[model samples]
Target: MCPPYFSSNTYFSNAIKITTFLAQSYTTMIRATFLSILVLFGVNLLAQNTPYPTRFELSGGTETPTYAEGIAYYQKLDADFKTIKLFTKGPTDSGKPLHLALFSKTRNFDLKKLRAEGKAIFFINNAIHPGEPDGVDASMMLLRDLALHPERYPALDSVVVAIIPFYNIGGALNRSSTSRVDQNGPKEHGFRGNARNYDLNRDFIKADTRNARSFAAIFQELDPDFFIDTHVSNGADYQHVMTFCYTQEDKLGGVLGEFHQKTVLPSLYAHMQAKGFPSTPYVNAWGQTPDKGWTQFPDWPRYSTGYAALFHTIGIMSETHMLKPYEQRVKATYALLEGSLKLLGEKRAQWLALRRQTKAAVATQTDFPITWKVNREKFSETEFLGYEAEYPLSKVSGLKRLQYNHDKPFRKIVPFYDHYEAENVVKKPRFYVIPQAWFNVIDLLKTNQIQMQTIKRDSSIEVTQYKIDNLQTSRNVYEGHFFHNNLEVKAEKQIMAFAAGDVLVPVDQWRNRYIVETLEPKAQDSFFRWNFFDAILQEKGGFSSYHFEEMAAKLLEKSPELRQKLEEKKRSDEKFAQSGDAQLNFIYENSIFAEKEYRRYPIYRVE
Candidate 1:
């Protein structure tokens, strides 16, 4: 360029332009590469944070989240949102912290304070049977959505949601792929039994484990208006993905019962149906096909819902079908919970009033029913959607096996027998005097938070008592005890002396229903039926045939009435007539030598 005789200004200008072009090109390439990375990283972050079903689909697959994962989800929610607060109640049987994740607009987990703050409480217990882990995962997703997308769950504003993230932590930790063999699609799941191999659901009333005792404390502390325990059903295939086991209305009774039946349950079904999940009552019929008929499941205090009912809480056990895909089950469970919370929020005042009315009624009622019998004639009919079931030959066993043909779906009218009548009733006395010797029953009463006063002095009072006349005990052990059946009871009025420190359970309080149900001899699941009073059912003393021969004759002669009864028994029973020892034993049992306390119930009623 210099050789071409150009001016100094022109040469300088061409050099500056080439340098500027290179610098601009380099800067543009660097900026474009950096922006491309930012876009990719943002997409990855969005994918990771997107809530389930999307999250579950992208990462967790068809399997449920592990116990650790569930806790992490709660922890993350607490970290990310102002609405959630994470609490550790205590250590469970698995040595893991029993966690309760609370969701409220105000972020207050204190139940009493929350109630005072004008918020209705709704409690949820998940993974009760760890194998039925649908609720566990569903609950996590729900709380997340409620926090991140508050507009979606409008009902949460009026209610404080408390959830036991993993109710059966022991069972939840005992994970295996083959445990839930019947379930449709879960790579792995928790076992049914807790660490101690106990079923926590059945251990509720007994409080046999540390877990149950802790649960009792939690329940009494919260005193929630509504409670839910989630589960999965292993039964015949059906069209509906969701079903529920609500505390029986006939058993719950009074205004609370009517409210649940007429308003709460129907609204739950309607809300779920509107959300694309049709629901029904729990498939209570076990052996029978759904199209044929079904009865309401009887929930004893051993069950979670039944235990909640004693405290006048409206409890429902949500159950999803096991045959359905894991994703579908979880979604259905989430819908059920969402619907229930919405209904609870919408009718908070009515729920509060209903509970108040029930408590008032229970406080003054004189006669309370303990045992219930199904009213088969009083059933209502409903349309049932189910698959045709048949007994087909098993390919593995070469025997007829129960199978549901999902290919052949059918809908028909089915009998839904949900009504119940009190089979037995007990007069609610001023006080139930339990002797000091029955520490087992005493411990249970204390665990249930039943109000009891200890006697200060030895006192004799006229009261009604029971004598165990006959009972049939199971040969096998059930829940670490020998359960009884066919119990024959004889009531008598007696002047009984109670020592100091004896527990006096007054029936005038709110827990009157629980006291009567557990203490009354006629109640099906009473302490006596559970063999807590088994000592009363056995002969403490027996005589040898050689020693009691003369004594037997003398005893029979002393009481002609006893002799007549013995003769009638011998005449009727060939076995009694043939055995000499039987005659002697019968005479000995009738004689004064037999201890009166042997068959006498330790429980007495003071009125």
Candidate 2:
């Protein structure tokens, strides 16, 4: 370096200058890097401005339970009063396993001790419908409040409160923000029926849950003392959040007494009233059971409350109005749970008294003759063939335009009497009234989204042909009606609960004696070879060819056409499909019914 002799040459001078420039550049970059980090910190601080923060960590459930904030909150609850079981896989649907968090004070709270101290309370859950998301939301709120403020939920020591925030995991995921972004359905709608599109509520009694298995699992494992199912009602039908107990006539529901009334319904009612929310109640008796939950479906066996009530346990089902906002529904749910817990906590001398009385009444209960509504509005009168024509969607549109200048909502049915003709025109691609409404009363069909025909019999707006068209189905809806020649019954209730397989319904025996139902049975063209009197005398739950001859004898008394419809089998366009989409590869041919009679239940009052 000494030999190079300093900056004597210009080339040496330039090299020295370049080295100095490079050093300065390196120093500047280091300073710039520090400045960038400072800006980033400030931006993040601005993003999180709330004092009490919420982070949507998992993305689909709640705004809580994220790694950054809610973990500490949940941890606080776990540390204070409970054990958190990490369901590495909460539940599975199709092939995917879902992750869930189950928080309970497990061993800390002993059921035996609670029972010894007379302070045990079980939960009845409702609110699995994703569209009516309040029950689940309220569940989380209740969990947090109880977990954080144990003193508030003092009953936790005595009561084993289970928080099943999401009953239908898949449905909830679809409705949540993360999943809603790409929910798959008709037109990408957020409303998705399970994997198979059947309402879980209706799928209870039947065991056809190829769509989901959790319903069956929970039913067997937790025979909870009280059951609650939360749902939403159409805006037109309900005014506010309502409670349904077995109707007054059904006051015979022995165990669901004052405790149910005071602890569950009153609390929910009072809570919502304080919130200025509107509500209604189903007739105390009629709506309290799954069999009477509007229309019956095969899934009565799996209904949480239905199972509870059938076993003489307490049950409560709450329905919020659709018109209410999402936040309001959530608030309502919070109020419901809070009220329920408070009621449960309060000592009930009346409940114990009622329980003793209920047991006594049940022991002596009788099968008082079941004279049902054989002549409900649908069955009040039979208009002879050619008396009225079926109404289709197109005609209803025309009526709407003519009457309200299309200002009225697209109604499923119409106004005016003898609009019956317009209501039952089966000629159109979409007929709403005559066939749909008529078929259900006879217990001949099970369908959804049917067209309604307008009937002006009652002030109730449900008289719309479009609305009446949907006769809610039951597990054995037709068991009461199959009193024809081909189908036979002998002093027993026989029903084919599940769909008849291709070789099931014993077509040949049923073919000649009774009205054989086909894909498209001709309107009013029916023949029968049975008599009504003998059919009634037989006392079979399902009808048979023997009953058909009995019904024929009834033709001599009142209704003549009833006898003729036997032996009337026509090709039908109406098809029953297990999968809602109708894309599932299944043959709807030769569904033969077993001659087997449905088992009869001698229904007796519990109290």
Candidate 3:
């Protein structure tokens, strides 16, 4: 058994060593002007000294370390801090040892300990993609901050975080050289393939290659509580904010997914949204795996968010705003990472309870026939769901018609409770809009003097809401994409910019999310559920969907196409099915994101 150490301390150790080792790693390090240590050193000092280093600078620049280098870098530092190994494995790989590093307290690694503590986060970034240096740069700062303040945060106690910081050592070595430039910039920022020209992110659903065993072993060993994929936007379209592609708004949290969504994400978003760093919240209600799922075919990554719900993990995709300075992007990203850990630590009790209940629910699924509610009002619902991720556009689209998009998101509200038997109709109490805005939309409604009441039941909590909009005011008028509005919306270079473009509108649509009709709430209540396993998340509510694991399971079971695709993965990578490659790809697609590197390949069967 591997020894467990304080998770933050483990990080502190990793950060300190990476820098310390990189400074001395080689007699002749990469000497490209862009890959200098002076910048990293200065930034490290600033982060170490400043109460808040303004922004977190993760690494110096484009220096791709060998797996041996990365491992050795941390091992040396791990010796100094409160570091302990959580697990160790040697899996089959095309060329190397499948090394997996997990740093947490000895007690914390216990499944029972995780159950008792209840909050965890994982970050994924597969190698350094020329165009997507944000994840690499940002993680450098995050690692340092954790190392610097091991005792400052108790939240690290309830949290366990993992990072696939570098996946393509070979690819990074051959990547073009330039400053934070995308493929089209600075002479050296467009290369996007790993060493073998394989995209780690796309390889997940069926990552049958040299690194397959590494991926499998890691997945089997450290099934994280949350998965975070760090990547860049497709182009310079959006502003700087994290975007999510998975949810529990549709299903009941299949044993594990419920634990993260119900207990972790809400609190995490709330803390960051409240941090005074002007930005729009990013979340989605459905699986964003267009690669498979929906479009009729449906085989998604079983180790990523698609599997998160099944395993009770909260999956996140950290897509940085492309237009922003890489330093700023990295800073915001580090904060997001830090913020997530804080939420996990603070909500340990709730998360732990949810974890237990989620597990119990899955176990009970065999006898009780647990059902999930799928909202069919998809057109309006997609628009509604779209508001969170593609808002401002959603808001503009809805308002352009001068018609209030249906408050009810979906056309059909089908509860997935009893798929094998007669389904029960979900009783709608006049209106049901699970305001995807971390429950803040509830207050927005109250600000408008809306009539809404939060009711508490034994098993689940419900909010019965009504708007009292007597005046037809344009409160939601063109708010300039939320960037220049009363609230500052951080616009990135990629995503948010897309909606605002072509529209040639009066505002940068990326600045604001869907302008939900706000009538304002007059009162509030804690509709705590006593019986259902959901009440544990009363403080962090308003997720769009749930039960990811069940979603994956049922979908895989029902759809032969999806099953066949997944089966191919099992067959091709049978020998290395449980290696570090599985874990790496899981992280690559799910968390620890970087643009060019993470999204460079396709994971779905290209058939």
Candidate 2 displacement at residue 595 in angstroms: 9.6
Q: In angstroms, how far off is 368's CA in candidate 2?
A: 8.5
Local distance difference test scores for all models: 0.80, 0.35, 0.38
* Of 1 and 2, the candidate ranking higher by lDDT: 1
Please give each candidate's TM-score. 0.88, 0.46, 0.46
Q: Rank the candidates by lDDT, best first.
A: 1, 3, 2
> How big is the positional error of residue 66 in model 3, measured in Å on the Cα after superposition?
7.8
Off by over 4 Å in 3: 1-72, 84-94, 105-131, 178-191, 210-212, 251-263, 275-299, 363-607
lDDT of 2 by residue, 89-125 (tens): 2243533333233334444344345445554445645
Q: State how far residue 122 of model 3 sits from its true place (Å).
A: 4.9
Misplaced by over 4 Å in model 1 are 1-61, 79-82, 390-393, 397-402, 556-565, 571-574
Lowest summed lDDT across 10 adjacent residues in model 1 is found at 1-10
For model 1, residues 522-560, the per-residue Cα lDDT tens digits are 786787777777777677767778878988888777889
